[model samples]
Every structure is written in C-alpha cells, then in structure tokens.
Target: MKRFLLHLLFWAVYLLQDSIMQFTWTMSALPGMPDGERIRLAIIATVIIAIPKAIFTYFVVYFVFPRALKYPALRWWLCGETLLVLTALILAHRCLNFYIVGPIIYHNIIRPTSILNLPYLLLTIMDLGFVSGYAFTFKLLRMQLSGKEREKNLLQEKLQTELKFLRNQTHPHFLFNTLNNIYALARKRSDKTAAMILKLSKLLRFMLYESGKGFICISEEIRIIDDYLELQKLRFNERLSIQFHRNIDQEGSLLAPLLLLPFVENAFKHGVSETRFNSFVHIDLQLQNEILQFIIANTTNEDRIQPEQIGLGNVRRQLELMYHDHSLKVTNAAQVFTVQLTLNLQSHAKI
Candidate 1:
C-alpha cells in the first residue's frame, strides 16, 4: 500500500512538472497560445514525452538504485547504461515527433528523423534528464534512509546478544558464591545446611525464571536480596555485622532483575569472608519519585579495599547498557569500600 502511494506520488509530480515545462515553452514560442492550437500541441507533446520518462524513472528506482547503492563500483556501469537508455529514449521521442505529431497535426516535418540531429537531440536529452533527476534524487535519499535503519537494527541485535552474555555471566558468579556458603555449612555438619539449600533452590528459581524477564517489581528484587543476605548471615553468624536500611515508596516500581545484586554479593564475598575480625556490610536502598538510590559499604582488609573487578564490573557494564542516564560510583577509603548507584525508575516504567 505504501509503495503504491509513493509510486503514485512520484508519477503525479513528474507529470505536473512535465506539463508545466511544455506549457511554458509553447506559450513563450507563440507569446499567447493563439486560439488554443499551441495549448493542444503542448498537451500532445507532454503526453508523447511522458512514456519514455516513466520508463527511465522505474528503471532507476527498482533496478539501478539498489545496485548502485549496494555496489558503488557498479556506478560507472550504471552511468554507461543511463547514457545508452537516454539516447534510445531521445531517438524514440524524435521518431514520434517527426513521423506522427508533425505531419499529422501541424502538416510539417518538425525535425530530421535521424538521431544525429544535434539541437533536437540535446533538447530531448535535457527534458528527460530533468524529469529523471527528480526520481534519481528521491530514490537515492530513500536508499540512504533505508541503510541507516538496517544499521540501527544490526546494532540493537548486537547489544541484546552482549547483554544476554553478561546476564549469563552473572548467574554462575552468584551460584558459585551461594554454593560455597552451602558447602561451608555441610563441612561443619551444621543443621542449617538443608534449610540453606532450600533457600538456594528458591533463589535459583528467581534467577532462572523471573530474572530472565525484561523487568521485575522492586518488591520481588528486594525479596531476593533478603534471601541472599539471610544465607550470608547464616554462613558468617556472629562474625558478620549486617545493617540494611530501605525506604521503598513504590514497591510496584520495576528494574532489571539481579541488576543490584552483584555489589551486595561483592561486599559479602570480600568484606566478611576475607576479614578476620569485626567485619560489617552496610546496605541502603531508597526509592522516591521514580528515582532509586542504592548504597552499599563494607569493611575490608586495607589491602583488599579494591576487590578483583569481576562481578561488580559486570554489573557496571550492565547498568551502562540498560540505563542511558544513571550514576554508579565506587570509592575505596582506607578499609571501607563503598558503592553508590542512582537510577531513574521512570526509565524502567517506559519499558
């Protein structure tokens, strides 16, 4: 339907421009188009020339345009083809003028029948050039816009694949840590081992199923965080001090699943596990007016202030891909490592 409309519009513009050009030339030659005779002649001439012009327009649009845009090296070949076609069209127009219109309507030969009539040939070529030029410009512009759209789609696909890979990377990093916690309990023959395993199962269900979804509610995400923290608390017992503060005004708000977990996991893995004495992990999450602010700080050994950039790096890259305008900052001051992240929840609402 759209192609039909575009073709219709192209022809309409071509015919209008051709008729105006013919009419102007006829009026200028006769000064007044005397008794409607010149007007009739101009109409006949416009109609006769329109056939070859239509042929050139479609030839370029459907055939030449795509090939030329795709293979620029073929442009010289296209130019040669254009010259041959233009010459043939000019010859055909001259034949129509001399054999049919001139002898029948005006009762006189207008020009020589041969293609070598330089002045008549140039005029015919110029008229065809002007009409075809319109189609040429239109088709070229359409091709450029089409190329841009295709490039955009390819880039989007690449980003999606990369994000999927990153998401996959996150899963194992988390599972490994959770499994270590479970292993520690089993090694100690602790009664909490089976219960932690059950928690791990639930966490797996959320990560495997819900996390794959485009977005999940803040409440669901918070539940996952609570589970994770609880599992960690079970492992560290009285040795780990955990302080969690949350002010969630919009529990219905949504964000990418497991998006905030890496930092939390990072703090637990390095802060509590590596430190020998008085280790603490502090987490604060606040959501108000469609903005979510997350802060996590943990006490680590001075040497381990900056942990290996694996899980946190993955999360940072994910944030960049997911949020256009977001803030993530990591600071290491003495033995305390801090992560600050602010996200526009309104952006997720759009998704």
Candidate 2:
C-alpha cells in the first residue's frame, strides 16, 4: 500500500510539471480563450499525453534494462528495439492530441498537414526521453545502494564467524594445560588436587556461559585471572613467585570476552612450566582514560624457552579482528620473557 502511494505521488508530480510546461504555449496558441479554459485544456492534454510516456518509461526501465543486463551480447539489439518502441509511443501521443485534445479544446476539427512531421516527432521524442531518463537514473541509484548494503552485511558475517572460531580454539588449549597440572597433582596424591579441580570448574563455568558474550566488564576478566592465579598457586606452592599489580580508573570498562586470559595462560605454559628453579611471574595492568596497558614478565631458563605457542597466536588474531586501535609486543631477552599489550577501549565502552 505504501509503495502504491509513492508511485501515485510520482505520477502526480510528473503531471503537474508537464501541465505547467504546456500551459505557457497553450495560452499563447489559444489567445482570446479564457485563462481558466486554457488551464483546463492544458491539464487534460498533459494527462492524455502522459499515458504513452508512462508506458515507455516503465517498459524500458523494468523490461529492457533488466534483459540488457542479463544478456550483454544483445544490448545493441535491445537499444534498437527500445528506439522503435519510443517512436510508436510518440505516434500514439500525436494521435491522442490530434483526435481528442483538439476537438475538446478548439471546437474545430483542424488537422495537421502530416502527422509524421519530423520536427514535431523530434519534440515529442525529447519530452518522452526526459521522463524516461529520470526513471532509469532512479532505478540505477537504488540498485547500486542495495549492492553496497549486501556487501557490507556479508563482510560483517564473515568477521563474526572467524572471531567465534578463534575464541573456540582457546578453550581446549587452556583446558589441556590445566588438566595436565591436575593430573600431576593427582599422581603425587596431594590434597591441592581437589581445590585445583574446583577452581577449574569455576573457570569452565565462566567460559561456558559468560565468555560467549561480545564484551564483558574488565573487572570480570580480572576476577577470572585472580581465580586462575590461585589455581596455579596451588600447584606451584612455594616453588614459584607470582606478583600482580593493577591501577585502574574504571573497573567497569568493556573488553572483548576472554581476550586477556590467553596471554596469561601462555605465560604460565611457556615461561613458568618450562623453568625448574627460581622461576617468577610478574604482571602489571593499568587502565587510565579508557586506555588499557598490560605487561607480563616471567623468568625463563635459556635452554627451555620455546617458540610461539597456540594460545598467544589465537589471542593475536582475536585482537586483530576485534580492535582496530591496539598494539601487542613480545620480547625474549636474557632470562626474561615479556609481553606488553596496549588497547584503546573508548570505542567499545558502554554508555
């Protein structure tokens, strides 16, 4: 119903414009006729002439244009056919003017010397061409806009799929390492094994429920890291030295879910686990003015240092997909392995 109204509005506007153009010439041609009568004749003539114009416009825009696009090799033939149709429509316009409008407006059945007059035919062609051009241009603009919208939607879907895949990869990698620790403690018959399993259960609960979200509060992420640290502390006991420092202005700031845990997991797997004696892990996190800066350093034995692992690689890809304004740097020097990450969180912050 709305579409029908729009089309009605378009034709009404076209009739008004055509009536105004015809009124000027009509007033001069039928001088001595009353102004009211001249206006009536002009409007009637425009309405009658518009029939052929409307047909030609719709046929070319709806039929010819689509077929031309579908069959590229037949475009020239379509163009020639369109010209013939335009000529027929112009002739029909002349017949309506000669037989109908003349007798109604002039009260005399005056006939032209030849209905095939070249100049008159050309003038009719120009009038019809103007409206057809307008319709075709509108169609082209709508097609272009729709195409761009579809392309944008497809890109968004692709990015979302890739992010879900990367996020899934982190789950098993993290669980594998944590389960190894639990298995080791169980073999030793240590009492900490049950506590470690409980912590692991909590972490799993968060991953299963909360981690699937697009974003989470920074404080929730901090709580997860704290629980993970406690779990690790149970396994290492007094053998590992761990230190964590935080300076945050807004604990409620938003970040992509599970984005930070992989970094901490990588640090433990590669640095703390590979070293035998005198191992330490230090982590510092600062959030000021919607900018997050995270740094983690761990003591490492030179011979035991391994190559880039899956957790770090997955986090790097996630960062690339999620944040446009962020930086990550990794350094391994002497007996220290360090990771530094900075993120601009203003874009993702909740209002």
Candidate 3:
C-alpha cells in the first residue's frame, strides 16, 4: 500500500507539471482567450494526451528495460521495436488532440493535416520522452539499491556459516585433548580420574549450552577456563606450574564465546604435555574500558615452535570472523612460545 501511494504521488506530480506547461503554451498561442477557458482547455488537453504518454512510459520501464538487461544480444531489435511503438503512440496522441479535444474546446471541426508532420511529430516524441526518461531513471535507481541490499545479505550469511564451522572445529579439538588426559588417568587407575571426569562434565555442559551463543559475559569464559585448568591440574599434579592473572575492570563485558579457550588449550598441549621436565604456562588477562588484552606464554622443549596448531588456527579464523577491531600476535623465542591477543569488546557487544 505504501508503494502504491508513492507511485500515485509520482503520477500526480507528473500530471501537474504537464498541465502547467500546456497552460503556458495555450496562453501564448491563443492570447485573446479568457483565463478560465484557457485553464479548462489546458487541463482537458493534458488529461487526454496523458493516456498515450502513460502507456509508452510503462512499456519502456517495465517491458523494454528488463528484456534489454536479460538478453543483451537482442538490444538493437528491442530498440527498433520501442521506436516503432513510440511513433505509433505519438500518432495516437496527435489524433486524439485533433479529433477529440479540439472540437470540445474550439466548438468547431478542425481540418486534418498530414499525419507525418515532422515538426509536430518530433514535439510529441519529445513530450513522451520526457516522462519516459523520469520513469527509466527511477527504475534504474531502485534496481541498483535492491542489488546492493541482496549482496549485503549474502555476505552476512556467508560470514555466519564460516563462524559456525570454526566453532564446530574448536569443540572436537578441545574434547579430544581433555579425553586423552582422562584416558591416561584411567589407565593408571588413579583416584583423580573421577574428579577429572566431574570437571569434564561441567566443561561439556558449558560448551553445549553457552558456546552456542554469539556473545557471552567475559566472566563466563573465565569460569570455563578455571574449570579446564583445574581438570588439567588433576592430570599433571605438581609437574606443571600454571599461573593465571586477571585485572578485569568490567566483569560483565561481552565477547564471542569459546574465543579464548584455544590459546590456553594450546599452551597445555604443546607446552606442558610435550615436555618431560617441569614446564610453566603463564596467562595474563586484562579488560579495561571495553578493551580486552590476553597474553599466554608457555615453555616448550622443541627448538623450533610451530604456532599454527589446529586449535590456534581455528581460533584465529574465529577472531577474524567475529571481531573486526581485534589483533593477535604470536611469538616464539628461546624455548618459550607466546600468543598475545587484544580485542575491542564494544565492537562486538551488540552482536
């Protein structure tokens, strides 16, 4: 209904413009006529002439424009056809003005001239072309806007699908590492296996429920990291030294779920688990003024470090997909591997 009203408004404006032009032309041609009679003739002539203009305008905008876009090879043929139809409509407009409107206004039968009066025919064509040009410009603008909207929607959908896929990859990669720890404890018949299983259950519950959300409170993610560290502690005991320091000014800040876990998990998998000697994993997290900074440094035995682990790669892609205003830096030197990530939480807070 709103669209219909807009179209009605456009046509009303066009008619008013045409009527004014006609009134001025008639006033100049018939200077002796009264103002009231001149206005009536202008309005009657405009109304009668608008019929062919409307047909030609709609035909060019709706019919010819779409076919030209769809079939480029037939453009010349379409152009010829359009010219023929336009000529026919111009003749119809001339005949209607001469036979129908002339007698009504002048109260006398008018003599017919050659239907091929080049000057008058050209004037009619110009009149029809004026309105057709407006209609075509409007149609082109609408089509361009609609195309941009569709492209934006498609890009959004593709981003979401890729994010979901990355999350799915993180879930299993995390699970496999934790389950291996549990399996090792089970083989030894260690009493800590049951406690680890309980902690694993809680972590699984969080992953199943909270991880599905696009964003969650920073505190929730901290809690998940705590549970995971405790589960790892049960496996490694005093052999691994783990330190977590947090200086959070805002506990309720929101960020993408499961975004931080992969770094911590990477520290454990490549640092603590691979080392035969004592190893240390230090994590520092700070959130102030909606900016979150996370740094994780861990000891590694290998001389050369491979930072692109599957878990780290997945988290890197997730970060790219979820946060536009975030940066991640990875460094390896002197038997220590480190990952530093900084995020602008406010950018994704509303997502």
Write candidate 2's Cα lDDT for 1-351 as tens digits. Answer: 976786788789989988988888766667888888778878987898899999999999989999999999999999999989987898998887677767765564333446677887888889899999988987888799999989988888888888888888899999999999999999999999999999999999999999998789999999999999999999999999999999999989998888888888887888888888898989999999989999999877787555678998898888877887899999977688899999998654221
- lDDT of candidate model 2 versus the reference: 0.87
Sum up the clashes in candidate 2: 0
Model 1 global lDDT (CA atoms, 0 to 1): 0.82
Better of 1 and 2 by lDDT: 2
**RMSD, candidate 1, Å:** 3.5
Q: Per model, state how many residue pairs clash.
A: 0, 0, 0
Clashing pairs in 1: none
Question: Model 2, residue 231: displacement in angstroms?
Answer: 1.3
Each candidate structure's TM-score, on Cα atoms with residue i matched to residue i, is: 0.86, 0.90, 0.90
Candidate 1 residue lDDT tens string, 1-351 = 998898888777767666677667556445644746766776776777688877877787677877888999999999899778877887787787777666665455243556467888788788777777887888778878999999988888888888899989989988998898899899999999988998899999998889989889999989999999888888888988999899999899988899988889999886667788999999999999879999999988867456556898898888878887789888877788899999996664221
- Taking every candidate in turn, the Cα RMSD to the unseen true structure, in Å, is 3.5, 2.8, 2.7
lDDT of 3: 0.86
